[model samples]
Structures are given as C-alpha cells and as structure tokens.
Target: LVQTWKDDSSIFAHDGRLNTPYSDHLLGSKYCIHAKGFEVNTARVGDSLYYGCVPVILADQYDLPFMDILNWRAFSVVVTASDIPNLKKILQEISPQEYSVLQANVLKVRRHFQWH
Candidate 1:
C-alpha cells in the first residue's frame, strides 16, 4: 500500500534498496529518513528538540488522534501529506522569532487549556 510515483517505486525495490537522495536535495536538510511501518512511530517518538529539522508528520489517524494524549506542539507541526505545498510556504515565511512565539503560545495553551 505504499504510495509513490511508479518510476520512484521500482528503484527502491530493485535490490532491497532503500533511502532517497531526493530528501537530500531539500533547501536546508542536514539529514532525512523516510521510512515505513512501526519504524515510523519509533523515529517520531525518539526525536528531540535539538533535532532542529522540521518534521513533516505524515501519519493521520493514529497521529491526529494521539495529540490529545499530550501537548506536542512544543516541537512539531502535523500536516496532511497533500498540504505539503502550503506547508512549504509556511515554513519559509515563519521566522525563527515567530516560531519561538508560536512555541510559547503552545506552552500557554498547555498550561491554561487543561481541564480541572
């Protein structure tokens, strides 16, 4: 059920090959790991704030619903795969200072929005 362009798909399975140079070509990426299965969950859970890379969370159901368990916006943005184009614009225009403000707002929401 892996979704990918036909040409891109074959090259991956040609010899149990994995990983892509495409992620490497991104504007400021230092490293990128595009993976499948349970490994995806492990990767996301393991990432830290110092990672710096803006993780484009690809999972929908488990992810979208799971955010209710904890306040995670301290370090991530959850966007659907199709909305990546608009996300790219958001990433470009959102300055570091503004991003910090957004993080601070998230903390505020976490502290105040809790149910008593």
Candidate 2:
C-alpha cells in the first residue's frame, strides 16, 4: 500500500524511517496514523492530539481513552481492519472542509490526553 500511495501528495504513506524528525512530521501533518501495536491502546493517539494532528486510528476493538466524554468521531477517523485496503480512499473522501473541523476539535480535546 505504501508503494502504491508514495506518489500521492495527500497521503504521506511511507514504509521506513522518515527523513524529518517524527515530532516535526507530526506538527506538519494534518493526520497521523495510530495503528494498534502489541497493546490495544497506544500513546500514538495522545501524541497526535498533542501536536494538533487529527488521528487516523486503525484498531478493531479499541476502547478509546475518553469515549465517554469526548466524541472520537468529531476529531478522529476510526478505521477498521477490514477497511485497511480502502484507507486512502476513506481519508481522501473527507473533504478539506471536514478535515479542518476535525483538526480544530483535536485542539479542543487535547487536554484530555495530557498527563498534567
């Protein structure tokens, strides 16, 4: 999938190490991919929120940190494992106007993800 979407400007799909620092990349990007690692939850989501980047969460059964108080759908894109192949298409379908709303909401809820 990375190979197929490498040239697609809207999608920053890369396989290996990024030339730019990871934190810098997060600050510049509009969306950050938060795939589940060994655990069902990871700090990737929080990191994305901290940097004001909307999260693209790829988890089948994640109990998002603040599901009760925050509307995850407002600021993040939750993609199922079944839709991995169509990830790019799903993200692309989110118009720039909608993305702006998502990013704005990310800032609004970022404090919830902070330690202090």
Candidate 3:
C-alpha cells in the first residue's frame, strides 16, 4: 500500500484528510502523518495503529486523547522536525525485538480503539 500525506506543502494552509496515496504506496514505507499543519487525530493515525505499520507522524502537535489507555510511547517511534534524518536511520536499524513490541503495543490498544 502507498499513501502520500497529500498536505505536505511548505506554507501549510490546507484543511482535509491526508490519505496516504493508494495502499500500494504503503507497500514498504510503513505509515506516515505528513500533513502540513495541526494534528489532532487522523484516520491515517488510526489506520497505521490498526495496521501495525508503525506510524511516523510529522505533525507539530501530537494531541491525542486516552494516552493512559493507549501506549504511543511504547509502540511507535516519532521524529521531530530536527530528527527526521535520525528517524530514517532508526527505521533502517530497527531490531526485531523493537518491531515485535510495537506490534504488541498496537494489539494492546485494539480493544479500546475498535468500532463498537
């Protein structure tokens, strides 16, 4: 699957969902939150969480609720504006143990985020 954040413009003046291009674009890239401005909660976030691709969020604000219930710190890796290059390096060097833990963390949050 492939998905372009669709809102990564330099000026940052868009208001919409950043659908990761087609799923094919996501084949190996994992997941991303490359939207321009604010970041509350996005479908891509849920999709990546649900899909276990380890979301790479690019939003300035990671304002998510239920932090106590869901373990973003445990499962996913994040890169701030200055840390993108390091983030890429981390992606390339991720250990199997880390990957497995991330997957497990996703499952841990599954029941809480699932549709009723």
Candidate 2 deviant stretches above 4 angstroms: 1-10, 14-19
Kindly list the per-residue Cα lDDT of model 2 for residues 1-116, writing each as its tens digit. Answer: 57867898877878788898889988988889877766445477888899999999888988888689889999999999899889888988999999999999999999888875
The better-scoring model by TM-score among 1 and 2 is 2
Q: Write the per-residue lDDT of candidate 1 for residues 1-116, one digit (tens) a residue.
A: 12332354222212244376533333234222233344345343333122344334544433432456755555456655566445445465767776776545443443333334
Candidate 1 vs candidate 2: the lDDT winner is: 2
lDDT of 3: 0.57
Backbone clash count, each prediction separately: 0, 0, 13
Candidate with the greatest lDDT versus the true structure: 2
Candidate 2, residue 111: the lDDT equals 89
| C-alpha RMSD in Å of predicted model 3 compared with the true structure | 6.5
Q: After superposition, how far is residue 36 of candidate 1 from its true place, in Å?
A: 7.3
Mind sharing the TM-score for model 1?
0.41
Model 1 residue 81 CA deviation (Å) reads 2.5
Tens digits of lDDT, candidate 3, 20-113: 5545344344544453256645565666666555666554456765766666767666667666545446666878887788768766775555
Task: Give the distance in Å from residue 67's predicted Cα in candidate 2 to where it truly belongs.
Answer: 1.4
Candidate 2 positional error at 61, Å: 0.9
Q: Give all candidates' CA lDDT scores.
A: 0.42, 0.86, 0.57
Worst 10 residues of 3 by lDDT: 1-10
